[model samples]
Structures are given as C-alpha cells and as structure tokens.
Target: MTLEPDLRDDLLAAVPSLRAFAISLSGHVDRADDLVQDTLLRALSNLHRFERGTNLNAWLFTILRNLFHSQYRKRRREVEDPDGSYASRLTVQPEQGARLDFEDFRTALSTLPHDQREALLLIGASGFSYEEAAVICGCAVGTIKSRVNRARSRLSSILKVDATEAIGSDPVIRAALHTAR
Candidate 1:
C-alpha cells in the first residue's frame, strides 16, 4: 500500500539526514543519493507494515542498510572490467592514462582475499569506522582493523605501490595506500 500523505511528508523531511547517512555508507554521493531514493520508495511502499510510534529514523536506516547489502552482494557476482578494454573504448584519449591506472588498481584489488578486501573497502572506500565496520561484518573491532591491515599490506605488495609515485595519484589507490601507511 502507498504511504499516507502525512507519512510521506515525514519521509520527505528526513531526506537530508538520510542522504548524509547514505553517503557515509556508500562513499559516493551519487550512489548514496540513489540509495536514499530507493529507501524512500521502499519505505513508502511498505508504510502499511510500519508500526506506529516506532523510530522512523531507525526504520529508514534499516531499509537503506538492507538495500546496500543486497546491492553489494549482487555486485560480487558481476564481472569487472579489469583491463579497462571496455571502459577504454568509451573514454577520450586524455583520460585513458588515469583509466589505465584504475584498471591496474582494480586488478590489484581483486587479488586480495575477500575478507580483507571487504574490511579495506568498508573503512577506506565507504568511510566506515572500524567499530562500525566490525558491527556490519559481525566481527570484533580488532579483527576489522587486522583485516584492513592485511588487505593493505597485500595490495601494496601486489601493486608495489609507492606513496609518492604515479599510482598514488589515483584517488582509489591513494586512499588504500594512504590508510595503509
């Protein structure tokens, strides 16, 4: 059932904080906004199921969190363009150098063990605190830190990443390298 007018208005008012939380979770503003929109739509559709007098903020967050995890899982099975052959064909000449670095970074990222990769992405890319990531990953904070550390070490080893070098200029690689150091 659709949300009543009053409930919809309340949801609209919560957009800003919801967007901020989404950005924190997703890192990219674009992806976070998309998640917020999806969350709003889901909340509206499921309004009938929402219990009255409950915490709307918590409800919306739960919806967004569930959506992010679902999308994350879906992306895990999708093939990535490691060589940038597909992306390269669509980019202009000037941007191709950056694109190549991105491809190498992607290749190096894929080499890490899945747990480490998850920890790294959660803290480095997604901006989650170690404790928050541990909560999400169902592990202790120390475990999350250890996983991220191992992931960073493995990535540095695999890519021979130098903090002062050209590869470090790439933001994605730089974030990992920066945090590792």
Candidate 2:
C-alpha cells in the first residue's frame, strides 16, 4: 500500500526527528536532510511493508535507521568527520569570546592540513566515536583517535590557543575550556 495522503501527512510530521537521527548518523546537516528525504521516499514506496496497528513513527524511524546502517556498512568512510574535534570540541571557550575574530578562526581552519582537517571534522565536528570514525576512514581506530588529538594540538598551536585564554573562543570550546580552566 502506498502512503495515502493522510499517511503522507503523518510521515511529514516525523521529518524533524528523521533529520536529527540522520545527522547523528551522517554528521553533515545536508547529508542528514538528504537521508531523511530518501527515507520518506523509501517509506512511501514500501508502505505495504508497514504493518498496520504498529507504531508509524517507529516504522519510519526503522526505515531511516536501516537506511543509514546500510549506507554505513557499505562504505563507512563516505561522510566521516574530517576535522578531528569530533563536533564535541568545536565549541568556543566562553571567556575567550572577547578575543575571538570569526575571520581569524575561519582563516585558521582553512590553513589546517588536509589530514588535520579530516581528523577534526570526523572527531570534533561530527562527534563520531573513534572506532566509528576509523571504520569510516578505513583505518585503525587508534589512528582515528590520534588524528583527532593531533589535529586539536595543531589547532591549539595555530590559533595560539592559550590554556589560560581558552582553547576555543566558541561556546563548545568554552564549555570544554571551563573544565580546562
């Protein structure tokens, strides 16, 4: 059975959760949106597979989650967080806000080496586990973890990130920096 007009509307309402789950799986916002759209389309096509009386939201989530897993298993390396900070560390250190220049931060990120960029994006920007990142990168998990750390060190140096001044001027960094402080 195809998703009827009413079912389609119900499907649409779950898009937000789908997108969020997609991002958690894929790391890139655009990619997440794309995944969500793909999931909806897939659901529409396979609506007959959905068991009536089962949870519609759960069914949709299963579709999206399964799709993500399929993509991940096929090629984990497809959308790895290239920057090492794992999305978790991208926050700016609060107290250092006064010293930040958005331009400088952007420029500095651009100046980072490719490997460094990859490391930061995967670990810092995406928030992937090292094991997951490594699987995605087709490398040892340790290598993935190391790349993240090394990239952080490189950024700290390039940005002249003072332990005292805060490692990042961004709130993410600020929260991390608070512990450091």
Candidate 3:
C-alpha cells in the first residue's frame, strides 16, 4: 500500500525543517540537499516499518543523522588526493635499484684515501663538527674540512653522481650526499 494522503502531506510539510536540520549538520548546501533527499526516499520506502501513532519527524532526523555518520566513517579511511601528488609518492622504488646504488656508494667510499675517508666518516657518518674531528685526528680544523670536501668530490666523481642528485633511501647515504651538495 502507498502512504496515506495525510501522511504524504505531513512529509511534504517536514521538508523545510529537514533541509534546515541537514544544512546545520552538514555545513554544505549540496550535501544537505542530498541528505534530505535520501532521508525522504528512505522514509517512503520503509513506511511499513514506521509506526503510525509515533513521531515521523524524529524518524527522518534519525535517518539523516545515521546517514551522515555512516558517510563520515567511510570517508575517514579515504585520502582526498585531487591532484594525485600524494598518490605519486605512494609508489615504492625497486629494492634492487636501492641495493645496487648502495653497493656502488660503498665501492666509491672504499677507494678514497685513508685520511680523506676518516675525515668524511667523522663528519658525515659520525656527525662530528670540523673542530671536533680535527681534535680527534690531531689536525687543524681547516685540514679536516679540506679532507672532507676532497673525499666527497672524489666519491661523487667515482660514483658518477651529480653533486645535487640524491642516491638512495638510506639515511646515512642521503645525509652524506646532501652535505656534499
């Protein structure tokens, strides 16, 4: 059976209040209109489940609230990447590439002179300042700086990497390259 004439009129009269409630809940006119339309559709479809003597307005409001909450829960897991920048960053580069890059870096580092390697390691890997490295190496701070610079230049040339280019995902390797640049 269809909705009674009086109930239909009641539903028609409830539209303004429903729209206002929807707007207040959603804070967007387009979304509020959609919520009200969905609520009316659900109410009409499920009229048999709605008791006749009870409140109809409350039932519609409950439906609208439940719809909003369901939408919210579903949206919580979604990322709004309209421009695809976030999606672009989600891809993992091949593990083999990183491994090969790391091996190349190690080989280049091993070819550096002993003093230059010590200076680069003390400054880049060990996080020591030039003065601190000089004290440890029993040399002048300028000498330590020169050795690090020479070592970085030699490694970059040996690895065939541009000074500005980043190599691998390893933090230590990245830090060394970044300082070199």
Alpha-carbon lDDT, every model: 0.83, 0.71, 0.86
TM-scores for every predicted model? 0.45, 0.40, 0.50
Model 2 Cα RMSD, 1 decimal: 18.9
- Of candidate 3, the 10-residue stretch with the lowest lDDT total is 172-181
Taking the tens digit of each residue's C-alpha lDDT, what string does model 2 give over 1-181?
A: 5547877788878988889889998999987988898898898888788887789999988888998888878776655577766766666546544446445566676777776567667666676767888888888977776666666666667767666254434544432222121
Give the residue spans of candidate 3 off by over 4 A. Answer: 1-89, 179-181
User: Model 2 off-target regions past 4 Å?
Assistant: 1-3, 77-181
What TM-score would candidate 3 get against the native? Answer: 0.50
Tens digits of lDDT, candidate 1, 1-181 = 6557877788888999999999998899999999999998898778778898999989998999999999889988886899988777774446667788778878988888899999899998888999999999999999999999888877778777645264635666677655543
lDDT of 1 at 9: 83
Highest TM-score scorer: 3
